[model samples]
Target: MGRLRVASYNVHSCIGIDRRFAPERIAEALLDIDANVVALQELGWHHRGLSNFDQFAYLEKMTGYHVIQGPTKFHARAHYGNAILMREAAHTHQLMDLSWPLHIPRGCILAHTHWKGEPLVVINVHLGLTPWDRRRQLKQLVHEIQSHRNSHVVLMGDFNNWKPASVMFKPLSQLLPECTDQPTFHTRKAHAPLDRIYLSPGLRFDTIKVWHTPITAKASDHLPIVADISF
Candidate 1:
């Protein structure tokens, strides 16, 4: 394929900023993007937030894509963390346990996919909250992504880096000469650039936009970042 559209969104576990659970709204937002692959963060499974719904399966059904759920921790009926939804079955997939030594649980999903005829790796991450934790997580994250050297990489998710110049991102400086900052956090106002997508070498970018439709603003706390990319 010449280019595939990829998107990243923090769905806030399908809980809207208004405190209502509307998985359909999330689906609508995704439909608006019409992406080939999506990296989702802050997703919940059978956990209380989902009202016992299998959020992973639901998304797959809604978008007609295969899902790879990467749970950071298990709960009574489900787990919560990051996940990847691809247009086709993943060649391989793994979850990164990003829980810091003594901090909250977090994770990323590594799903190996094919775009056009090239092998591609999607690192779907939802990072830690505290500054201390994020620093360590970044280093660990770098190590994780670097291991898949032979494939074209796409790192995208809710990074939660409040500061625009966070040193925690230095580890990936070589890859981010130009970043797509659409300010996705706090969808109501959307002043924070917390959700992002980074593409590796040889991949080209045609468009980078925020899907901020009315429904999207109420679906989650963060708006979706959609990127039109090609290899």
Candidate 2:
């Protein structure tokens, strides 16, 4: 009687193998998972550097969930980054721009939601490609989590570290248990498990799965990771 479903996905800008970008497929994927909350990476906000695509709105409409976007870079062409979606309406949200030495801007979206009257903080982030940058981003993320020590935290996203053991994992390892119950990412050909879902000690995992449906595989280079938890 104490479990919540969570998922993290990199939508590859919502671009599918059909050579088209569709948010609806992403919605369908989420629906299939039936997660209580989801953290998404590589979500595009601006259509062409000036206009906003209803990406978040589309998902919210399809799934009846509240959406919060955390953009890292805004160019004249488009805005891209992470997002947090939840079944319960968020009381408040914060967009932290974790753009570091990498030219590519990375970010995390912190959302506070009331699930069954209990406050929960979900952080959705995409780390940098380089080991050094990811290490730094990890430190910053751990710092951010430490700032709100009293809150229940769920951190999920694409760490992009092919190796299972790395310094990048240390920052979060000290605070949460790594949900390695399953392998995430690379449904196309098992390229590597680059995605992760880390949960704080306050929460316990009830179910962990990798969404690797035929449709999901074509949706992006990575498969989605879902974890059901209870506090």
Point to the candidate with the largest TM-score. Answer: 1
User: Against the unseen true structure, what C-alpha lDDT does each candidate score?
Assistant: 0.82, 0.78
Q: 95-153 in candidate 2: lDDT tens per residue?
A: 88778653578888899876556667888889888887788888889889998777788
RMSD of each: 1.8, 2.5
**Number of the top lDDT candidate:** 1
Pairs with steric clashes in candidate 1: 1-116
Instruction: Write the residue-wise lDDT of candidate 1 on 41-84 in tens digits.
Output: 87875444855677778888898878898877666766777789
lDDT of 2 at 136: 81
TM-score of each: 0.93, 0.89
Model 1 / residue 211 / CA error / Å: 0.6
Model 2 lDDT-worst window of ten: 45-54
